[model samples]
Target: MAREITGFSNPLVKRVRSLREKKLRKREGLFLAEGLRILTEARELGVLPEMIFLASGADPHPLASALINAVEAAGGDVIFTTPDILGKMSGKDNAQTLIGVYRDRLTPLPALDRARAPIWFVAQAMRDPGNLGTLMRIGDAVGAGGVILVDDCVDPFSVEAVRASMGAIFTQTIAHASWDEFLAWLRAGPGQLIGTSLNTDQDYQAPAYVPPAFLLIGNEARGLPAGYEAACDLLVKIPMLGRADSLNASVAGAVMAYEVLNQLRRTGDQGTAPQAPE
Candidate 1:
């Protein structure tokens, strides 16, 4: 049985609402995920939220009901609340029927698997949560091993980023490191460090990306810091046909990431090579 929460001052409600603040979320080590799709994806990924809140009288879709039941079976609590209460917690106009409280899932830099062609997207000083989320989704879509956030980047756990990810946040592995730490890791690892730069005349497609490649992108505003290109095994640029100076960080990353996949696929490295003329 789901308990009914009617008051705005409820302790659990307050806690969930507080997650909107990065400081509070960091202190508590938990974040909120709103919407049925995200919650379902999280559940499918074996991520069990600490608590679940469903708006009373909201359409009880079969999947949502099943998720609620599963949570209760697993000793997790489920609360049915008014739409207003849910909206307050979700910080939205009309909140989704299901909102979940989940623990943060950031991981430390893992040992690069030199035996396989693993791709990693490295974002340096990325500040836009929406862009970061989109990048995460792109990373997940292209089967990248993980996303690495360098230095003081925007919080991926923030509501905007998580929501923009459209559930990729649950599936993708996210890592963090400082500039110095990343440099050290790059030297110690067997991966090729690839960077994007306008100064480079090389087309993005020119690189025959090796296994365990790290695609390093810079901040949205200023681009990569000075001398960073020296560390790259290869520097490539997406051709600018229009007047724009550069594509958005997320767009540039997606373009480069897909190219890497395309190269690998054509080369038959991952066993997805095109068929020969029959």
Candidate 2:
């Protein structure tokens, strides 16, 4: 049975609202996933939240009911609250009918499967949560082995980023490491580290990316850090046809990541490449 929460001062409600701040999220080691789709995805991925919130008076669809049952079976709590409270929890004018408080799932570098033709997407100092989320979605789309965050990147668990990921957050393996630590890992032989840069003469599509390719992307404004290109096994660039100097960080990462998939497909190398679009 779902418990009713009527007051805005409820501790669970306040904790869910506090997740909007990075500090609180980090301190509590929890994050929120809003909407039926995201929570369903989480359940499908076997990631049951610590608790779930349902808007009072909201229609109880079969799927929603199933989720509630599943949460109860898993020894998790489900709270039914007023629409206003749900809205406040979600930080939206029109709150979702369902929201989940999931534990942080970020893993250490050792948790990544380095033996498989491990194709990874590495982002350095990424500032945009939306872009990071989009890259996570793209990484999942292309069958990337995992995503590695280098240095001080935006919180991948942020509400904006998680929403942008469209549920990839639950499915994808995420890791964090410093630049040097990342370099050490690369040298340990997970695969080639491919960097993207405007200064490079090589077209992104030209290379036949070997298995275990790490597609390294830079910050939105700074691009790759200075002197870092030399560390990459290969440096490639996306050609610009229009007057635009560069592509968005996520856009650029998507283009290169797909190209890696394309090259793997052309070579008939399974190498963890996603199925070619039909």
Candidate 3:
């Protein structure tokens, strides 16, 4: 049977509310995911929630049922509470009766993985949670290996980010690293590192890309750091037809990702470049 917490002052309610604050989330090593879609996606992503809270008055919508089932299958418990309690716990202007407290997920990249080679997106100092989430979803559509976030990027698990990703959050791998660590990793990489910059002399489509390649997308407003441009093997830019100076970070990232995919397909069509004289 599901447990019931009637009062808004319940201890569990306070614990759940704390997740909304960054300090609390970090201290507890847990975060809250609102709505059924996010919770369901979390389950599919192999993230098991410790507990899920469902609002008493909110009918179990189909999406909610799916999320409840996932939680049950994972041997997790679900709690029921009144709307008043939910509002208190959620701390959102628009409260969703359903909320999940999931285990933190962090996966390390293996050494030069073949399956991912020729496609990777690097987010350097991207601070917007929404933009980060959208980029992850875009990466998924284009069959990207994963996303590498430099140290200054926003928390992928932020509430706004989870909503923006629309469940794509569960499908992508997000690896975080310091700038120095990223530089070292790039140096040992499978392909060259390409960065986007205003001063870039070459067009994005100019190069015939190789597999295991990486395209760097820096901050949307400030662009990439000066030192980073020098570190990259090649600097490239997207051609802008309109008056806008440049595309949004997420748009720029998706464009570059598809470009790499297109080149790979084109290379395949050309047929293996004929084995050299044996």
Candidate 4:
């Protein structure tokens, strides 16, 4: 049986509650995972939890049951507490039913050349968690390499972002890097570098895509940084027919990803040479 943990005053509860702050999350190299889908993805990604936190009424939630079974099977620890205590620990109104302590992937940046096989979505200073999550899902959909959270973006592992991702987070390789490091990699990396902007004279569909490209998507409100505009080998813009001006960050990212993937597939299809029979 999972150990029943009572009281919000417990030291473990206090520790879990502290995870709401980014500093604490970074310091501990851990993050919170709420809901069944997120937990399931974490497990499938081979992310063994350090510990599992479940509310008293959590057994009824399908995700909660799955999480308990998964955790127990992995020989991990599960602690049962009250909903009120869970709410206090999670720092969110909707976080009561299910939660977990997961070790952040924090996988070091691999050889950027190795990563070049897949397309990449780089979002700079993106603020909305939902937008970031949606972009991750899109990257997974198009079989892109992964989504890179460059510079001042929201915590990709946040409860909101994880929930918004709909479990797509597990299938994607998410790396956070500084602007200098990211730029350095881009300059030396194997993939073609592409940036998106409203001022670009080039249409999004005008040029044929050459993979392994990094399609840079900027913040919804501010767009790309000043330096990012000049960093790309080419900058392209989506044609906007309406007065609204711009698409959401997620929507823009999805369109660009699909277009690039389409072009790459076409190129691959054409490159396969016919074999002559003896």
Would you list the C-alpha lDDT of every candidate in the order shown? 0.84, 0.86, 0.76, 0.76
Better of 2 and 3 by TM-score: 2
* Cα RMSDs, all models: 3.1, 1.5, 5.2, 4.9
TM-score of each: 0.93, 0.95, 0.86, 0.86
RMSD of 3: 5.2
Best by TM-score: 2
Model 2 spans with C-alpha error above 4 angstroms? 116-118, 273-278
lDDT of 2 by residue, 57-174 (tens): 7578887888999999989988988888989998878675689999998888866776554468899999999999999899888888668999899999999999999999987789
Total backbone clashes of candidate 3, pairs 3 or more residues apart or in separate chains: 4
Residue 243 of model 1: what lDDT? 95
lDDT of 2: 0.86
- Whole-model alpha-carbon lDDT for candidate 3: 0.76
TM-score of 3: 0.86
The best candidate in terms of lDDT: 2
Q: Report the C-alpha lDDT of model 4 over 85-136, residue by residue, as the tens digit.
A: 8778767674565677887754445543334345788889999999988888
**Which digits, one per residue and each the tens of the lDDT, describe model 3 over residues 221-261?**
89988998888888888998898878999999888888877
Off by over 4 Å in 1: 110-117, 271-278
> What's the ranking of the predictions by TM-score, best on top?
2, 1, 3, 4
Off-target runs (Cα >4 Å) in candidate 4 are 57-66, 91-96, 110-117, 267-278
